[model samples]
Target: MLTTLTDYRLWALPRNYVKIADAMIQEILDSGAVFEDIADAPVEYVESRGDLDVIFHELRGTKGCNVQACYDPYIDPPAIFVHLSGNTGRDNFSVLHELAHHQQRVGDAWADVTEDITDRAFIKELREKVANSFASRLLLHEDLIDSAFGSGPVTAAGVRWLFDNSAASMQACLYRSLELEGNRVVMQADSDGRLFFSAANSDELFPPHKDKTQEEIARSFDRLQASADGSLVVRGGYGIQHLSGKSYTNVVLDMVLCDGCVLVIATKGRSEQFAFSDDGEYYQGSVCHDSFLIKDSPGRCSTCNEPKCSKCKSCGCPDKQPPPCTRCFMLLSVNDVRAGLTAHEYC
Candidate 1:
């Protein structure tokens, strides 16, 4: 099966760009340069590949440019100007993103995609997405992600772990986590509840233009318990009523606060069956009777050995049907007949 990362790249980037990016990554790996440790010296590694000039500039308020970095292939030997954000992870991403542009310029692949695209805005956006795909792949290699998170469910703690442990930026980890679990939305918002970034793999769209902030999402971070690595985490369902009058009711939010931003990993709300602790070490199951959360009993399926919720008795398998009622001669659901009963209780 194709990994979520592969699927995302195919969707976000042009085919030629993907091939070029993969080839570049493979070249780096073939050089015996530890690919997983690329974050440690990204600038050095990028510079080693070719003759490129690096410049640090304050790019704020620059007309026609709003990004933190840009590649200028017009200069002698080409130059990549980066505006440092002081955050190592984010800064490294900016550098790699610009380097990807440099590669595109050198390979002359720009001609391949630009001919048919008459819309300047679309061309610019496509180029940026292509560059982002390359940078994200370089920083968060598939192998590294697989090693960090094996085929387990993506959790808020897992997202926090990837950001805290790897060289990838928080946004990169959020995007990767979304790819891993395509049904959820991974969003980043300020402490004041203003949303700046969000990505979703689900059909339910986020509010158009991504500028609106709901106070409820921001307020949800209050009094959240902090884990060992200083990420504040909390889990609950909330009504995602955007300020623009668009609303989605009963969305499950798995939130974490780190580096002054609330990262909300959300899915469509469902009955609370099980919940993981802030560190993901403890699992709490809920009973159907009261939907009360219970602790310390991690039940398993007898046949498949798959873990089940001890209270609700839910596992990887589908709901089991009770034997048919002898009188009615119909397969019985749990509600109509009790287990091991050949006849309905009423019968």
Candidate 2:
């Protein structure tokens, strides 16, 4: 059931819960949780709740307590009853978002709303804003996402890192990741009603959802899902997208890398948002940069970072021999272990 913000237990909340919520917001902001740092957060589950579907206050005294907190403050606590129903859904960004609420002890009690909407309750909106910021940052911590973004192609592989870290939905993370790189990217979904997420500096990739008629979505969805690979390459629809390969393909969807144009649609695919891209542009990311995932792939002193360098005698990076770049040298010094080793899952 959808929860209305106004309807919740009021009298049973902790009298001081409001203050605790304030402190939590301040903490997250002081830590520099901004739009740029979306990928900085850790994505693991905090804990498990029981059969009691929703969690809130005592329903008697003041606005009650949060899921993981007592009347006492200081210890980090959650503000509401977070529904932990996501294992099959996208990466668990929702958990982190709710965690923000929990930490602030923001209760769902109606008293919070009737509390005069001024000082005490007045700051509620601001706190939620901070929690939202906290959640985004904690889930999409920029360093981690940037690391993966810089490391490899913004493909399913990198997304795995986001998933493991809890960066929320692939669409949001990819969009944010691209924004961090200063790229002009526009993302869209023409299925389940038309929806889109466009970069600030870029033009809209797809038309507004309202502008799309039912016929458009239905027809497009049909053409898109007919692929064996469960994906479709967009050729051009609203006269914006330019297809580099086939107009539409079941396996891969290629569009022109430009601003104000080019749209890729998932219509009906395993991945609602084409969050992972296998294009060459992704190879420029740090994850895939000059690194190949191969077991026993000998070291290469060559400037050309390639897998073939492993066996080639002319390669510059020799195994356990003198190093090439000072950076590479030191990296291999302690951890002579190579990329694609069975150690890491990507390997």
Candidate 3:
């Protein structure tokens, strides 16, 4: 079954990248600060605060330098700095990333205690990932993304709307959308077509980088980039062969360009297979045939007309013919896509 952000609970972030980010969000909520419309004004809380300092200046370095932001948490008054070389969207994300670091440092004294750790490289990378996750969440909160998708289909244009409104980079918006409510995979490659990072709800559904050489991965990347025309479905052995060991026969790839990286969101053609229900009950199949057998099950399985089934209720089944299930591809309405794209047109 596909897992949504809600499945992880309000502040329980399961991914390693967002573990500290979740804690930071919980701290904000616990402080009684109202963040009702954070997406529109992300810096509103910290901008007027006396303790946090934000700076922007010309940050130059050697050629091909990609350092656009930095955060200093050890100082008396925490500070965040962003390179003045990027666009508004990039600068927004940089500030939020540093703020994420500030939140972590304030919440725990031991957050910086890893200085003595031998793995400095690993620690640095982990901290960056956490900060990135923080920036994404701070701008595009779980509730906000959930509500956006509640009435529409998730598309590249929909993600663009999120980027336009929130203080997140286009890449961050795309990545977070992939993690929301679908069995999706987001593969990121450099301009040269070298695969650097891949995030997916299921490892089995995504192509495994561990088994492929850099050249092989590059070839697959090229194919995906060439075929991607906003949205495209790759079928049969042509596309499946590159995936090698994956069990899926086909994949729907949504490609978008952000900065210098190509972000591709891949959805498997086959439904997910699992043996458990949301209510902590063990099951053997995708749908419950006789939901009444389970204790404390909901009245009936809306998907299958079975009594006492909690899975159907958990998925919010509409009780339509061939009932709505997370295992299959969701039918997206064209109107929903258009509405989402033009959601902020008048604003």
Candidate 4:
């Protein structure tokens, strides 16, 4: 499904449908449909628009139906035929993705593309991409994303917050919340250590993730077994092995076990430690200036710019012992020591 740049040579790229999707959501909200109301019954909510009729059927063996859901523009009133996949999040997304197709037909958005120059497969891929984009926006908007995540990087709690707040799938929430940086990756794996999918930021320099779960992932599953409170999340640091025979150590990982799958967010190129203050705010304890998540941490050394440890009062600087004075031939006090001088300051 990964399409290269050359494939899009003759076809116009998909337009940004985020605004249109957001507008449609606004219209739905203005019609007195709250999120909770639409969440359980997305098809019902969309069907009420009178633009498209929803039909449920077993899509397999049906002529011309290959996807979980598809929109038929030729049909009078334009019907969206859906096969319930049992996964609520995915089913909802399929509905919305097909709805995007409905919009394309009504607006005649495909007219600008030169379809004859490209094969049908390329066109289908392009349209699918467009529809997926539209569906993602419809399920989760930017405003909601910011409100859920705040200023911190994507965390398990943030992912859970979005899941409870919106009707988007866990996969969609993870995809939408990701920061397009090369130093991070998000993965979904089953309980038995089988990877469903993995997504990395724009940096191709990062090595490919393993097809199956690594040792650390297995350890995480073991840790999850001790959750007496029934908590499904396990967050910690573990080395991740890349496919290139190299391993990134101490990668920050946040994992959540839900819907028979484990969702993981791994951050590389940084080490994070939580240090709390008396004011009830926590900061990233950067012992060696490796972490970039530092926030208002007190006791930063003016010389090294590293935070001084609360207990040791050390700022990652090496200890310097005063040398003996050449003239006195004795150990000198730190304050009295003068470097490269024959005598101390007092002398």
Model 4 ranges with Cα > 4 A deviation: 1-40, 61-67, 108-123, 179-183, 204-210, 225-250, 271-347
lDDT of 1 by residue, 71-155 (tens): 7877787877888878777778888888767666655445444555465654555567666666777777777677667797676
Per-residue alpha-carbon lDDT of candidate 4 for residues 1-347, written as tens digits (9 for 90 to 100)? 11232334322222332333444455446757676545556788778878789888784332333348878778788988888888777778888777767766654334334234345654555566556666666677666778777766776667667777777888777766553223456777766656776765422113236574555666677565566622343333334555544344435667766666666677643223423234523222222112222243446677655555443343433353344443332334443443455445664
Candidate 2 achieves a global lDDT of: 0.35
Cα lDDT of all candidates, in order? 0.58, 0.35, 0.50, 0.55
Error of 1 at 260 (Å): 3.4
Candidate 2 C-alpha lDDT tens digits along 1-347: 11233322221122223333344545545655443333333332233222112233334232222222222233344223333434322324444445555554544332343454444442554444344344444556557777666755454335445545553654445443443432233344445424344322211121223333222233455554554633444422322222221121112322211122223322212222233233421111112122222333453224544222223222222343322222211122212234423232322
Error of 1 at 297 (Å): 41
TM-score of each: 0.63, 0.34, 0.53, 0.58
Per-residue accuracy of model 3 over 176-236 as CA lDDT, tens digit each: 7755655565665564545655555532244436333233224444564575443333322
What is the C-alpha local distance difference test score of candidate 1?
0.58
Off by over 4 Å in 3: 1-19, 36-38, 60-67, 109-125, 151-157, 187-198, 205-230, 236-249, 255-263, 271-347
Off by over 4 Å in 2: 1-78, 84-92, 101-130, 142-148, 151-167, 170-175, 183-193, 196-207, 210-236, 239-347
Candidate numbers sorted by TM-score from highest down = 1, 4, 3, 2
Go through the candidates in order and give the C-alpha RMSD of each one to the true structure: 14.1, 19.7, 15.2, 17.6
- For TM-score, candidate 1 versus 3, the one ahead is 1
TM-score top scorer: 1
Q: Output the lDDT of residue 13, model 4.
A: 24
